[model samples]
Structures are given as structure tokens and as C-alpha cells.
Target: MAQKGLCWKEDEMGELVHTGTSSPDISVIRSLAMKHLPGSYDTMDVAFFAEGSFNKLYCVSSPHLPQDYLIRVALPVDPFFNRESEVATLAYIRKYTSIPVPKVLAFCSSSESELGFEWILMEKIGGVPLSDIWDEMPVEAKESLPTEICGYLKSHQDLQFIKIGSLYFSLVRERVGTRDFGETSAYPSLPIVVLSHLHINS
Candidate 1:
């Protein structure tokens, strides 16, 4: 779906700065679908699915594909690093645990493409948001929810790593700097402080 306004953010100085690209070129997005996803398509259905502080999402469906996909375009607050780290985090989680995160189909970490934004095309996880259904749940279901959530948290705790830092692809971390920020030999990592400050300041 087409969005009419630019994505904006307030900076440290309290000035409003435009942080994201507006409505992206649908034709280019469709071409990306054809290249990375299964089947062929002259066109696909795209509709605005949601928007958050950091990204805008679109649902894409095609006659040739088996299922719908979601496209998440970042608002460029931290540019490449934000998108790169998130993709890496998902990959690391899937590799180490059984959490059912959306599978990444394709992504561009740079905003140099025809779309002028970093986007990830991923398997659409279908369910109404938890907020929408929480009040209607049975008492037993509600009681069990925290246990389920804690299970996921425990899974994360079970993952062992050598460094306290943000995860990144091995190559991406190497390209980020030569000095050892954390460790990049096994799973790439950048010091957690860097990521923390980026988020705090952004």
C-alpha cells in the first residue's frame, strides 16, 4: 500500500528529522519478489500491513507463490547496521533455538538500491497481534501465556557466546572495522555499548 507521509524522527536536539523513505516504488519491489522468491509474477498484491517506530511493513501476495510474504523497510535511523544486526540476530536465534521467528527470504542491508531503503522480504507469520486477543483468552490460556513467553526467554539465555555484543554476519563484522570490537571469528559481534548508544541517541 502507498503511504502519503515521510517517516520522521526527533533528534537529540528535539528537531524533527525525516528518517525514512516514503512510499517505495512498487514496480521495483515486485521485481525483487520475482528475483528472490519462488514462481514468476508480472505483478503482485501489496497492501499496507503495519507501521512501527522503526519500520513500515507491507503484505505481499501473489498468484504464483504458495503463501503471502511480508516486507519490512527500515526508517534509516541507524542505516545499514540496524538492518544488518536484526537479520543476523534472527539467524543466530534460529541457529541456536526453536523460536519461530519469521524466515528471511531476501534482504538488502544498504539503501543504495532502486527502492532507496533497506528492506527484508520474509515469510509472513500469520496471527492477530497478541494485544488484540489477550482480553478474550480463557483463564487457563492466560495463565499459561507467561510460561510460554518465559520459555522463549530461557531459550535465549541458553545460547552461549564468547562476547557481549550485537550479532552480525561474519563478513559484515569484519568489514565494520579491523580492531576487535568484540569477536568476529565464529559469529561476528560488535560491542553491545555501540548498539546501546546508537539506540539511545537515535
Candidate 2:
């Protein structure tokens, strides 16, 4: 196989950086970019707007493509948080719900030959993230937000068994030293607050 000008290097921290970019363990991203966007190579533009501990995200754009996209680089410490399971669960959720979610364009796993980090490529959504706009909204808008969130939750309530296990439980276990307690009995009732409108319409 010919080298597609895609290779891994090291950042200042000595971590693997994919595509010669000064990012940590971007091998997975390099592979996906090379595969889906071969010969359309452009620079990776880092987004400083993120506020998370687990992933380094970038808003990637190219002159050849019409729209921008997001590339999420999974941290090496993510396995403890069940990264694969979360991705699988997201995939499962995407199958049944019409609620807006970033489309999973591609996923790549880490290996010695490639950047030693996992990453995912997703289509960027058009609107602002809830975190960015939530504080500026009116109280009425805030009230409606919960209803929308609950509607989304209710739609997936029937998907009792996600193909991947519970990420929340995994966090509880790692942080609080607890075991998986299975699904809570109260989960079904929680959605009623939002779904009450649906019941009235029916």
C-alpha cells in the first residue's frame, strides 16, 4: 500500500500526533481522513471553544468541501470511562430516534503502527451547543428546554438494552466504588413529566 502522506509524529508532550499535526495520538483521525477525504488534505484547525477534559476536538474544513466537521480525539484515559461502549450506545440510539445528533461518519481504533489514540469523525451540527446558549436564554426558553430533553429521553426509553452497557454506571463504579445496579426502577416514571403532552394529544 502506498503511503498517503499520512503519518504519525510526536507532539511536545511526546505523545503521538497524527498527520504531522501537533495533536496527541491522532493516528485514528489520520486514517479516517485519508480514507474518506483522500487527496483533499487540509490543515487541522483546533477549536478553542471546547470545555471538556476527555477529548480534544477540532473543527476541520477544506476548500473542497462545502461544510465544516468535527473530529473528536479520544484521550488515552478513556477506556476506564467505557469509550467503546458509549459509541456503541450512541449508534444504537441513532437507529431509532429522529432527535438531532452528530452523524458518525467514521471511527478508527489505535494501534502501534498508527497514532496510538482512538478518534471519531462526526458531521457538525448547525446550531450552537446547549452549553453555549443556555445561560443567555429566557426563563420560558429554559422551561421548554427540559421538555425537549425529556422528549428525547422518552423516545429512547423503550430501548432498554443498549448494545453497549451503561457509561454512567461505569463512572459510578470508578469514582464511587459501586457495582452496576442494573436499570433503576424510577427511570420509566421520569419521562412522564415530558411525555405528558403526548398523552394529552393521544
Candidate 3:
């Protein structure tokens, strides 16, 4: 087997600085809520929820909306992470399948955003993250969670794809687009796998 690999520069990001843990301007987030989710928040109640190495999550509430929201802001400038593709995938699963995913109330990609980074405003998912409460949870609940998640994953097993790439939807084309390639930490070739010229496309 012949091994082929794409050349990538370490400093591929020109001048775009990655501000890990540094949040975007609160005023920009406020303006976005007012503009897109006018029905949700006349005055945004934004609060710092948590921060990860790559993204910051906020808790946003509105008197108008039925539930609170979670606005995730990508802090790191990672070439592999595609927020648009994630939004598209969530929207597709929510629209076409029974899979449970947060509804994307609004989203802005890095280039199209006023905040200078990709962000997603979605319906807040209930319950604490498994990492936080897993240790304290009962064995019955732990067993059930994976069983339920596996069921969800099984639902989409019948859905097939020929080539692997980040998933995105084009409003102009009005369909799911899977052509753009980007780097990722886990998968080198967008969403596909190539090892010693042995292809394992997902």
C-alpha cells in the first residue's frame, strides 16, 4: 500500500489569532439576540455558563421564548473544526430524523459573523453534562443512557454516504452540501480516513 498525505503548514492561519478562553464582545451577542431572536429577548439575559479549551458556552434566557438558550462561541481558531458543518448536521438530523439535537435558533460562521468567530445559538439542552454528574448517577441511569444513545445512533445507520466530508447546507442550492474539505484533530482528511493508501471513508 502506498501512503499519501496532504502538506499542511503549521502557520496556515495567516493573521487570525486564536483567543482561547477569551470571550467575544458581550454587546455583539446582545445585538445578535435582538436582531434574529427579537421574539425571544427584548433584553437579553446573558450569563457566563462555562468555558472549555476551544469554546465558551453561555446561558441566555428570554421572557418570550418557552425555554432558555445556549450560545456556544468557538474561541480557538482550529482549521479542523467547522461550525457551519456542525450547524448543518444538527439542522438536518432535527429536520429529517427522530434524533434529538438542539435546534439551531441562529448561527454565524467565522467569515459571516460580527463577533469575528463562529457561534451558534441553540435551544438549551436539559440536564447536566454526563462528565459532571456521571459519578453520582445510579447504575440504572448509567446503563439506560448508553442504551438510549445507541438507539439514537442506530436510527441513522441506514443512511449512507459515498464520500466523507464536513456536512453543510447551502441555502442557494437548498440541499445538503458535503464537498468542502478541512482539517480536524481526529480525522486528517476532513471527515474521511486515509491510512497507508487504505481508504476508510466515513
Candidate 4:
């Protein structure tokens, strides 16, 4: 699901200047899969999956793996924290909870060689998005989902973070989490809620 965006540039004054979501062609996606995936997956069908404001997602499927894979590529000008922050976010979630999220198989926070983009390849979570099937569910199922959602949210209370930003893992990939913005003075560890996969009307 690649979208063409007009590349914008800024002047030396650093004033508001340009914006566009970077896109990767299919060949590049295939090459990336071949480079990073297991050798057994000699071939893969890389199909465009979806896109968000700052990211384009592609679905990678191979007979070797039990499930399909997803590649999430971040735009060069992503307004949110860097790609590492996203990788760390998913890593932190995986380390801390049993809530089902895509398992981060491989990621490059910094653009490597010709890739020129930060990307993550992971096991895709299977199911129709809650948004797609939400209103069609029976009232009982709809009521029951919130209780499950609240239960999941409650699980985050144990996760304590002092800053109001994304969390990142250290070199050893354990302990000592840091925010995307450089660290600040010690503050009270507050609870955070990541409203992903929820269908609440905002």
C-alpha cells in the first residue's frame, strides 16, 4: 500500500518547510526479506498490507514459517520518536506482558546501506481488526470485550516509568529503560496505557 508523497524541503532558517511519507518499491521489500529472513525462506510473496501517517506495512508470507510476517517501515520524517523507540515499545510490551502483539523478528533502527529507511519485520498477528468487526458482534460479545480490555489495561499498572515518552532497551536488551528524549530528573513513576487494538470511540 505505497502512497506517493511530495518530498518537501526546508530552508536554512529551519522554519516549517516540507512533509511526505517515504515509500519503498516492491523489489526493495523482497530484497530486504531475502537479506534478513532465514535461508529456508528462499522465496516469499510480499504483498502490500496497509499504511498509517508515518509508516507503511507489507505482509510477507512463505511456506517455511507457520504464520505470515509483517514489515513495518517508518517514514523518514516520522513525527513520533525514532524507529528504535517503536522497536523498544514492542520489545518492552513483549518482555512485560502476555498480551498478543507482533513478535519483533528483526529491526534496523538506523538505515542500513541502500535500505535508507528504518524497518521492522515481525510475525503478523492474525485476525480481523476490532474496528472492522466491532459493530457486528452480538451485544454480549461487545460487553465482554471491554472487560477483557480493562483486564489487559490493569496489567500495565505494574510497569513503572518516570518519564512521559517512549521506552527503549539498553545494549544488552535487558533492564534500564530510557526515553526517546534524553533523560530528565527523577520523577514519580506513573502508569501508562497504550490504547492499541481497542475500539473505544474517541
Candidate 5:
């Protein structure tokens, strides 16, 4: 498979940096959401929710849904590797630690998908950003923040991987790796390892 080239934009420092500017089709998005989302597509509402350096997020909600879901569409910047690794890492965290992370309901790592981009459909985690209320937080609350943050960090440190590369689902690793790979420290699912070849063509 041919590797997709990375997108670049000028940073504040005037240096070129990889940047993601994916804008997924809303109509197709609605169709995709309707597949897993509850309620009639005609009654469902899909709205832009958020954006990060590498992804554009959309919120999907319908009267029939138990809760709203987030659709994250990633830009072409690492194409397959970024999304696949992220799903694997999130799965690793949820399986191994007490850290709260979004639950992935469905995902597609291929840019060639029906939506024309890689996407993840996940349960929306409810909470306000810490930055929004940091100043309003009481001194006592601020004091304990570090401890709470460190607790999550500590949990990550407890996990040990034999290989230094990113984690991946066994299926993804098999599809991308040059050969069958060995398992790592009993991570709930099959283990994966090492660099660029970890992407899934599917």
C-alpha cells in the first residue's frame, strides 16, 4: 500500500509542523452514525463539537439514544497508524488501570472508509475542561489536583511492555507487521510492537 503524505502548516515558531485539517462530510456522518446510533436518521442531529491538532469531533444525538456519542474524524497526518495506535492505547488503559477514558463503540482506521476519513465512534465523556474552571477552583481543590493527576500517571507507570513501540490489536499488527509478532506483558488483548509498520491498510 502507498503511504499517505503528511499535512503541514506553519507553527507559531515559524517552523513547519504536521497538522490535521480533516473536514468529514456531515451527510455521510449522519448516515454512519445512524448505523450505530439509536433512533431514525431523519430525527438524529449531528453537530460539530470540537477540534484538536489531529482530529475534528462531532456530536451525534437522537431522542432514542441513551446518551450522546462523539464522532472523531482524523486528518491524513499519519493516516492509519495514529488512529489504530490510539484505539489500542485506550483499550490498554481501560483494561489495565482505573483511569477513566472514553469507551469506543465503533471505529474505522482506514481513510478509504465510506466516510472518506478515519473515524472513531465513542461514548461521550461528560465533564468540563479543567482550564474552564481552574481559576475558580478553591485553593484546597487546587492543592489536591496534583495528587489526583499523579495517581493516573502512576497507573501508567505500573504497566510494563517488553518492546518500546506503540501497542496495537493483534489483528492490526498482523496485517501491518512484516511477520507474526510476540505478545507483551499479558495486556488484556493480544500484544503488538515497534514503529511505522504498525499501521493497518484496512
Candidate 6:
């Protein structure tokens, strides 16, 4: 028989153990699998692959299908944290470019029922994540990645104002300002180069 979702392991003091999957609030894995997926997978089992501060990622498979897809369950971190916007952004990117993003299968925003969290079902991309590849990838591949990313940006250069938000730069500014003072601080600078190229191309 297939294994069910993991249960919280507790300590002798009756407090929850610090497992990677343990969260302070709740787990929406089962609700997401049952509600968002196709009718065929309504009764299928789900296994949690990972969880982030903002979302829980799971791999779901059934006897009917040979493969599994990823489900991203958005945790309500704040009122302004919109899972719908993230889904829409993914959909918009997929519609405009062939840069290969996860294909959005379904998205739900209502938070009224058993599925208390907003979620998105997306086609899983196969490959080692970029983090895993960092140490293994060749220098040439590393160099080419930036070029490929730049080409992707260039492809969407002609996008209308409505398609891409107007305050995109401001978003970048905010991210830069709020970023940690460590290695991650460099991320905010990449937008400057990309924006400069975009301006020239437009």
C-alpha cells in the first residue's frame, strides 16, 4: 500500500520535534491533492517533497499515471501575499516565452473550505535544481546560463505595459533594499543590467 503523508513527531515534553516538515500552523497537502487535481486523482495519495516559508511543494502520483506532478500550496504569510498573482505570473511567462517554466494546470484563490490555503498545480520539470548543479556544472554551462536568461528577457522586450507591471523596477528596488547584507545582496543588481538591456531594445 502507498504511504500516507507524514505525521508530526513529538518530543517527551509533548512539544513538536523539529523535523523539516513540521510547521507551526498546519499541513494542507491532502486538501490540495484532493481539491485541485483532476477527478481521477481525487483519491490518490500525496507525499511532501519539501516546504518553504511561503509554500509547500509535493509530488503526487496515482496508479493511473506513470509520472507525478508538483503541487505548490501557498501558506498565508500575510494578507498581501498573493498566490494568485504568483500563478498568474507563471501563466503569463509561459504564454509569452518558451523559456520553460512549470506549466500551471490549476489555481485556486478561495480560502473557505477544507482546502484552507490557496494553491497551484503545475507540471513538474525534470532535472537537477540549479542549486544541485552549481558544483557539478561546467564553466561553459555556467557562462551560457546568463546568456540564455538574457535571451529570454530579450524575447519579452516588446511586451505591452499591461502584460508586465509598470512598477517592476520599484519591486526590484524593494527587494534590493530589503535583502540580506550577505551574498544574496548581489541579486538585486542583476535587474539593473537586464533593465538597461530592455530599455535599449525597446
The pairs that clash in candidate 2 are 16-25
What C-alpha RMSD separates each model from the true structure?
5.5, 13.4, 10.1, 9.0, 4.3, 12.8
What is the descending lDDT order?
5, 1, 4, 3, 6, 2
Ranking 2 against 5 by lDDT, winner = 5
- The candidate scoring highest on TM-score is 5
TM-score of each: 0.76, 0.53, 0.64, 0.69, 0.79, 0.55
lDDT to native, each model = 0.73, 0.54, 0.62, 0.65, 0.77, 0.54
lDDT, candidate 5, at 76 = 75
Best by lDDT: 5
**TM value for model 1:** 0.76
lDDT (0-100) at residue 130 of candidate 1?
85
Cα lDDT of candidate 4 equals 0.65
User: On residues 1-202, what C-alpha lDDT tens digit does candidate 5 reach at each position?
Assistant: 2223336768899988874344678989988989876446567789999888777899998877888999998877666677888898888788888899998988999988888888999999888989999999999999998999899999989988665566667777655554444666464344545434443548
Candidate 6, residues 17-74, lDDT tens digits: the string is: 3333323223456555556566655356677778775668778777765557787766
Full-model lDDT, candidate 6: 0.54
List candidate 1 segments past 4 Å from native: 1-21, 181-202
Please list all clashing residue pairs in model 4, or write none if there are none: none
- Assess candidate 4 and give its TM-score to the true structure: 0.69
Residue lDDT tens for model 3, 78-161: 322367557767865675567878988888765346876678888887876679998999999998988888878886774454
Where model 4 places Cα greater than 4 Å from the true spot, the runs are 1-6, 9-22, 78-81, 134-139, 172-202
The residue-level lDDT of candidate 6 at 10 comes to 70
* Candidate 1 per-residue lDDT over residues 11-66, each given as its tens digit: 89998767544667777777777788887778788888888877788889987778
Any residue pairs clashing in model 5, and if so which? none
